[model samples]
Target: MPRLWTTRLLTALLLALLLLTAACEAEPEPRRYDFAIQLNGGPTGWPVWVEELTFDHTWWSPGGNLGGGFDKRPPSGGATAVLSRPMPAPSSVQARWFSYRTQTFYEIDLELPNTDALLQQWYRDYPPPDYRHYLMAGFSGEGEVYVWWRARCTVCGRDRSRDFHAPIVESAWAEEAEGDPGRYRNRTQEYVNEGVIPSPW
Candidate 1:
C-alpha cells in the first residue's frame, strides 16, 4: 500500500508540471492593424533613388518587435504602398529613409493614439479630404504617408540643389478583439509641412 501511494503522487505531480509548461509556452495575443503610405509631387529632373526604408516599433505588451524593409526604386509621378502587421500591444513605430543622390536621411516616429475619441471625430467629418497629400497619416497606421517634392538638383554641380522634402505620414486604427477574423473601423490624419529632408553630406 505504501509503494502504490508513492507512485500515484509522482504521477499527479508530473501531470501538473506538464500543464504549467504548456500554459507558459503559449504565445501572446496579437493586435492587428493596416498601414499605407503615398508620395505626392510632380518630379525632379535629377534621378530620385530610395536606398533604404526601415521600421522600428514597440508593442503594447512587455516585449517589442521590428518590421519594414528596403526598396531600390526611383519614385516618380508620386508613389503609394500598403502594409499590415500584428502587434502584441499599443506601440510606437519609427520610419527611416535614406536617399543616395543627396546623401541624406529622413526619420519619423509615431505613437499609437486612443481610438475611441479619434474614431468619433472621424465619423463626424473626415478632416482634409486630400489627407493623402500630407505625411501625418502614417501615424494612424493607414493612409498616405508622404509626398516627395524636389526643389533643385542635388547631383549636378552647376546649380546647387536645395534640401529635398520627404513627407512622413502615419495612421492606424484598432480592429476587433485578439483572434477575431474581422475588419474594424479606421481613421487617418495628415501632418502639414512637418517633414524636412536634410542633407548629411
Candidate 2:
C-alpha cells in the first residue's frame, strides 16, 4: 500500500476503535425511528466483488445492526435491510473490494460517497407531512452503501422519524466478481495469504 493510504487506513482504524470503545458502553435508547441500509451501486459492466464490507459507525444504537443484513449479495444486485434504531450516520466503510482498474482485490477504509449531495437530496425529499433522512457512500467498482432514517411505527400514517444510524454488517454481502477467474483467484490468494476466507479455487 502507498504510504498515504496506509496512513489513512491506520488513522481511520484507530479512530474507529476509539469510538467503538467509548460508544458501545452506553445503552442505545429506543427511538421513534428505525434504520435501513440500501446497497446496490457497483461497476458499470461488471458485478461487484465484495470481499469484506463494514460500516464504521460512531454512535450508540441498538444491536448496531445495519440493514436487514444485506440479504442480497453482489453480482445479484443490492439489498435493503431494516435495523433497530436511529443514531448518527456511519462515518465510513471499512471494506475490501476488487478494483477493476488494477484487477486487484484490496481493502481500505473509505469515506462515505456523495454525502453533501445526498444530504441535499434528503432535504428535498422531506419536511412536508412526512419525510426521511438518508446518507450515502460508494467506491470505484464498489457497491454504494446507504443508511435511511425511517419510521418504525407500522400504524403511523407518515414516516415521522428522519434520523439515520448505521453497521456491523454481513461481510458475505460481497461476492466474487465476474471476470478472469483464475487471475482473480490467484491475486486474491496473494493478497489474503490463507486468511479467513478459503480460496474457492
lDDT of each: 0.31, 0.42
Best by lDDT: 2
Measured against the true structure, the TM-scores of the candidates, in listed sequence, are: 0.31, 0.36
Candidate 1 segments whose C-alpha is farther than 4 A from its true place: 1-28, 34-50, 56-78, 84-90, 99-103, 108-201
> Judged by lDDT against the true structure, how good is candidate 2?
0.42
lDDT of 1 by residue, 162-181 (tens): 22223222222322112211
Which ten-residue region of model 1 has the weakest summed lDDT? 181-190
Tens digits of lDDT, candidate 2, 1-201? 599999999999999999999898987752322335444433343233555556663432112112122323221223444456654445566655564334545455555433434444444554323443332223334344333333223334554343323322323233334445454655446534635233444
State the lDDT at 68 in candidate 1: 23
Report how far off residue 4 is in candidate 2 (Å): 62
